[model samples]
Target: MVSREIRASVHWGVAHALPTVFLRRAAAQGDLQARLIRVGSRGTDEVFDLVEEIRARGPLYRSRIGYVATSHAAVRHLLTSDDFRTGLPTDQGPIGRVARWAAPTTLHPVEPPSLLVTEPPDHTRYRRLVTRVFTMRAVERLRARTGEIAADLLDRLETRASGPVDLVEAYCAQLPVTVIAEILGVPEAERARVLEFGSGAAPSLDLGLGYRRYRSVTRALAQFDDWLGGHLDRLRHDPGDHLLGQLVAVRDEGEGLSETELKATAGLVLAAGFETTVNLLGNGIALLRDHPDERARVVADPALWPNVVEETLRLDPPVLLTGRMAVRDTELAGQPVRAGSMVTAILGGANRDPEVFDDPVSFDVGRANARDHIAFSAGRHHCLGAQLARMEGEVGLRAVWDRFPDLRLETGARRRETRILRGFERLPATLRP
Candidate 1:
């Protein structure tokens, strides 16, 4: 039987989703021994593999927390279904006890809601505001700037002409952060602080942080929020032609955004922008080095870079799993879901579903259906930054490989030790000819 504590915690929005995710994961592994698959204690690379193994066990498996939808059919349906929502149907407050139960037994105040964990109206509105910035037309305008950023980073990496390079730090990590910081018009002096705070708060998306880490994240969020408030205020006073100025205009027009919404939107954009591309660059480069035939093909014909991008996404997406809650009693892939109970949809499994792609396990850049993979997820909740992320990958990957024809892995990468974000902590490589 589910505890009343968890029941309350699970029923809310973005401000509460992390605790709910933590509770469900903890309960799923700790007590609900019904078909325990040992998601806990696995290394970062192994975690996605484990999810894939569960995915192979047919489409839908009833895990302790709601359902684990792994098949292409199941994941796509669950994400797209109107019956499932990112949050509970109601705001139903007084959830302090629930937060304590989710984390350690300590009081936690509600935080600003992110689009990731909000339902329609709220989610739709925020999505509209963000989509205005990332439409293909808008993203296309950034192409020249993004390409220049990528080339500059790669050029710097080339200066290291000899010895191993920590590409994760020197190239992969720096490129996306720089591009996003520029897009937001972040001051040159404050850019480092923004990413530093971003790095601290990022783990809020995963489990096993316990209380201390959660506290640290809360502090970072407040600091980032403070900086964002000032930044947005400045943009409002003198609207430029940048995305920040555009967002400020959105906020000032019509119903306009509340102070909370303004801050949350900026924070969400910053959070969404950085890590996805960084990890994608790291993962894609590493994959290219490991597979020389594919590497040679990609470098030999850079036009195939998009195909390479698609394949890398399908094989190792930056985000491994996403959660959805049942808004009303409904069935997913034949499993009955009760309202408010959450489901963990394993994207890694869905991408590799045999039903969707032939030779699913092996990475095949030429696979016709590579683009079909929902690496950015599906439905209204799909990544708003999808176009931007692809552009970054397209520019970043090809630039590095094309620039350094002899690029290859130097030492082993240190995986992030996280299950939710399947990526690397550091990736080392060589650019010697």
Candidate 2:
């Protein structure tokens, strides 16, 4: 019962496949009390049906979920909900089970035990400790540094041979890594290696790929741990102004974080900080390239970069999915969800929900509610680096446009194979020098 308008706007590209699978799986579960709602290319009709289904069956349901190969809902539900656990035993069998499994050790395992994985106390504790480091004030302080990084990147991009340049590699990918390295106190010379290692650690279920990434992540983690551990020891003797130095000084009645916790926290910050920001920059640039009018508007008024970034997140978020595990059977949106189920909140899909956003498909940089988008997520576990990411996006995009107002996308834009993190692997563009 999806609406024609929504259906018409359906992006039937490869990206839509996986989410569709989850929707279909939920529909096919064969549970009499639970029904799966299908919203096809019919737009409002489909959305209407989806709303009715949610109202009738409740938000949480018990069924063998089938998902569209690339639907946003499928991925979001898989990653962010308690009704579906990514790493747990599921009726989906080996292939299905392995596909969703998230290991703390893996960098990109179709799933991973990130801050997005755990719920309640663990999530609460981790979030509380880390949240302080990424506040608006802290992010504001980093603005100057972020601007410097953006300028350096633009300089590099400008100097590149005037023909088609891979924007993703030349500018998007490098900026965030440099920013993160500076924030984490990693030597500039080591930033590339760290990025390489962090990339390898990302979760990809392909056994060969996953194993290789795991090894790279492990080795990198060891090196980072050793370096940070030594740095912490020194900081205890002589403190500095960086995050790691500050973390070492924090204490709760003389009971501070264990070395393991510190290392894990630092690693998480480093990996999440740079990777997500990089994708955001890349995705935003690509979106502007595709939407010339919007790009022109932003270029004409650099202040609109924030809104542009926000709209880009709503339209094509870098982090496509996030997950949570159910501690007990509960009713969500009315449906009965068993205890220990996984609940995936479809941020991307939800952000685009026609009921929530008017003209959801169009990229409107001036949309009043653009900032309300769930790109940084919601609730207690919302992204700690939200402000930092925004600063990076605003400053980075402004720099790009400022340097080359006539930047145009060349043919052949391919998104990376990593579904969890949605972004371009390569984006060739011509900059008018």
Residues 147-205 of candidate 2: C-alpha lDDT, one tens digit per residue: 88888778777777478899877788788888877776777777777777556555332
Give candidate 1's TM-score: 0.86
Best by lDDT: 1
Candidate 1 residue spans exceeding 4 A from truth: 1-43, 88-112, 250-254
Model 1 whole-model lDDT (C-alpha atoms): 0.74
TM-score of each model, paired residue for residue: 0.86, 0.74
- Which 10 successive residues of model 1 have the least lDDT summed? 103-112
Candidate 1: the clashing residue pairs are: none
lDDT of 1 by residue, 241-325 (tens): 7777887887688465666776777787887798888789988988888788888777677788888888999998988878778
10 residues in a row with least lDDT, candidate 2: 7-16
Q: How does each model score on lDDT?
A: 0.74, 0.62
Give the residue spans of candidate 2 off by over 4 A: 1-114, 204-239, 249-254
